[model samples]
Target chain A: MESIRLFCPATVANISCGFDVLGLCLDTIGDEMTITKTAQKGIQITRITGADLPLDVTQNVAGIAAQAFLEQLGTDQGFAIEIHKKIKAGSGIGSSAASAAGAVFGLNALCGNPFTNKELISFAMKGEALASGCEHADNVAPALLGGFTLIRGYEPLDVIALPVPSELYVTVIHPQIALKTAEMRAVLAPEIPLKNAIAQWGNLGGFIAGLYTEDYNLMQRSLSDKIVEPVRSPFIPGFDKIKETALQNGALGAGISGSGPSIFTLNKGIKTAKKVAFAIAENYTETGIPFEVYTSPINKSGVRIINR
Target chain B: MESIRLFCPATVANISCGFDVLGLCLDTIGDEMTITKTAQKGIQITRITGADLPLDVTQNVAGIAAQAFLEQLGTDQGFAIEIHKKIKAGSGIGSSAASAAGAVFGLNALCGNPFTNKELISFAMKGEALASGCEHADNVAPALLGGFTLIRGYEPLDVIALPVPSELYVTVIHPQIALKTAEMRAVLAPEIPLKNAIAQWGNLGGFIAGLYTEDYNLMQRSLSDKIVEPVRSPFIPGFDKIKETALQNGALGAGISGSGPSIFTLNKGIKTAKKVAFAIAENYTETGIPFEVYTSPINKSGVRIINR
Candidate 1:
């Protein structure tokens, strides 16, 4: 087949205790892209929908990802992708990564699936790096591989797809306000206290154990952010109150999702997820700020071919 | 049931990436202690063996642990303990922790296990605090509860016992050279760079995931000390060469066992564990330095009563 259509779901990264290292994909809210072969001997962005992002082939996330992957393939065969995004940009929900990972994933299928998942992630990171001046696999890894993920290291690029508890439900509340990723990262201290670093690693270990063993209480206890959120929460308004309400309303634990403006609560069931969404919505709805909430079980299959 | 005979196993704290928050118990080496109910109305250190540890109830690790426990229990019943140490002190193999944890484990069992594991760890920390000028539960928690463990938080004393892979093996080599724990800790920097801390946490998350999923390659990849070992490894003689030899000779990964001098390597089977031990031992024996080696599977049952 010379053409493929795919859906790459949104991702929630930096899961509180696991800043920049852990992430989970969502079942809803994604970017759909169609990759088609063209007579032209180069990769290009044919169309972009739902938001006014860059349209130039060299400047777009999808275009960059496609160009990188096709270069790796060493092929003169031409390809063009049309993207329809449902996830909002700069929402701390890996919206940009959805476009990047989706293009690579869809293009790989059109090229007969020559590359591995890790390679696809490598190609996809070019898009994120071009946009943010850094390469982060936390969002794109899960968005491509699905489920819970741990980007173990970067020197050799270790990425592992971790097990996700079947009962886990995610509720993401995205406030309309945009928090630039660069500015969100700039708020963090360059050096962390040794004690705090130790605590963070401990929580990360326990959190991973909870995911594999399906220990809900352990996961809740391990959901603390002793490092990242404390430093960056000031950028997101009403962060503490929404988190407290989410935790009090039967949600297991809550924290700022990804970077800022989007807060997420984890729960044991969909009902609790909906309850948390309403409770968190109560904090933002009356303030005349436009917001979006998405509830989903942990996404088991990340980027998939929704249409052939 | 006036007296009890129990053994507390040696432990390897700082499990590479975990720093002060992760550890595991070893089956081969330990401190054997017999705790007896006495007619006297106080805790006492009656007999000590192997190393010249302080015997005073206030200054001794075992005595401090027992005193703290009896005080918290608030009972008029008195207790006396006799310790026979097989693990070497100042060797980076948790010899002191064996005494401290053994005292609490034996006394609690003699008292019909009144306190929970967390309480036992709390009681045990007093012993370490009195000896080291700080309270650390990495070694004691795993020694008391067995298997791999994560001390997620310290303010409220949160400890979680993690699962160990059935096929995992530990090889510990203790060189006769003495490097005090205080000196070892002194070598470490007070603060860690944010990038290094991120890498450490990432490895820790992957390590825990590998444990639960029984992924050996991931565990081997994750067994990296991005924080402590890099700073403290200089204190241990032939550290790099020995670790390189072990890794080359079928060991999964190798690092300083606890603080200094002693080096531990993890592998899949007893044969490889033996091979790695010999390979590492070759590095020390040729230098005319006295060293002891112990190999065992991951201890599932930590402190246990031999003759109940």
Candidate 2:
């Protein structure tokens, strides 16, 4: 294929009780990108629309990730990329991850699929670092491999693709406030109580098990964050009321999505998810902060080809 | 049934990354107990053999568990209990849990099972508190429910039974040394580094995912302890060498069983488990400490009737 148009998914990271390690893909929200082979031997960001982002090869997440992929592949083949963003920057819903994962994914596909989707994560992580100031896989992994992704470890880059329940739906509301990942990370303490840590891991285990069994109630019970949410939620306007309203309106569980200004809830069906979206939207209207609410099914396929 | 004789399986708690929350039951290593309904109006420890333990109802773990069960049942009918112990107390192999769980299990059977195995965990925990100075359900949950268990929360006592791989085997080495759980707990700081906590939960989520999928490689990678093992392993002599030998001999993973003095390794089959057990035994013999090693399959039935 001379050119590939791809749909790169937005992801929800820092899931409740799964902070820093777990994330899932979304079906309805993403960025569209096209990668075309060029005669010149280097990466290029030819165009971007719908968002103000750097176009420099060194500064762009997609450019950085594409550079890392080609460098590893030892290819002189150049690629020109264009991104049409739909997910907002700094929305805590893996905006940069979609671009990064999409670049590597499209490149691998055009390069005769030299790398598996799992193999593409590290290359994507390089771009992720440019955006988050750290080489984190929580967002990039799910955006690459789809479904629920558990970052088992980072040193060797072990990422596991977890099973997704058939009926799981997500409701995400981005309050359009700028919450930098670095700034939000600085608010967390370097140390945590051992008891709370135990509770956190326990709930994580339960949540994973619930996903495999499709037990919504167990998932609800396990979807709690004791360590990170309490400190970061205060920064987001009306975080408490939004979460409480979501739960009351039939969300299986609700919490601050990623580092806040955005909140998410998992529901069993689309009907309840939309209800939760409407209720949360109504509740947040009082805060006088403009926000976007999205209701989507869990995306089984991460990055996909849109057109050829 | 007027009288019942049962086998209460031994359990291994504090499973590597699952510290303070995960555990599994054993098939061969356990205790035998007999409980008989009597005309008397109070619980009694009728006889004890194979281990020196108090026969007093209030002081004995079995008695405390039985009393808890009876009080919850609101029964005035008395029962005579006798325990034939095989698992040594303070072995970090859930010896106390065997007795505690066995008491409630037998009483429930005689009383037509007023409480389920999951429900019996709380009653068994009452007895466990006397042994560990804290009410912990890690061991008792697995011992009562049979197979692997996760203590998701302590406030409302949510214990989840996880799937056990059919080929999974366990090897445990009990170094006959006095290491109290409370003392071992003291060696740990009240707080832990947030980075390590993140690594811990990541591995825990991976391990649970591995169990559900039966991926041995994933299990091996995930069965690691970062927070507790470093500080507590020193208390167990030949800890590093034993773990290395077990891993070298094809054991999936190895770590301290509970608090200290006992170490356990998981293997795919009985042959590998026995090989790992022999390797660990040889490695520990140099310490000149008397130790007993046992290899067994995963117990599916927590406590079962032997005779009635």
Best by DockQ: 2
- How many angstroms is residue B11 displaced in model 1 relative to the true structure, after the best TM-score fit? 1.0
Docking quality band of candidate 1, CAPRI definitions: high
Supply the DockQ value of model 1: 0.86
Model 2 spans > 4 angstroms off: none
Chain B TM-score by candidate, in order shown: 0.97, 0.99
Over A235-289, each residue of candidate 1 has an lDDT whose tens digit, in order, gives 8777788888898899988888898779988999989999988888887777677
Q: What's the true lDDT of residue A22 in model 1?
A: 90
TM-score of each: 0.97, 0.99
With candidate 2 superimposed using the best TM-score fit, by how many Å does residue B100's alpha carbon deviate from the native?
A: 0.6
**Residue A152 of model 1: what lDDT?**
94
Instruction: Encode model 1's per-residue lDDT on B125-176: one tens digit a residue.
Output: 9898876779999889999889998998887788888889988999988888
**Candidate with best TM-score:** 2
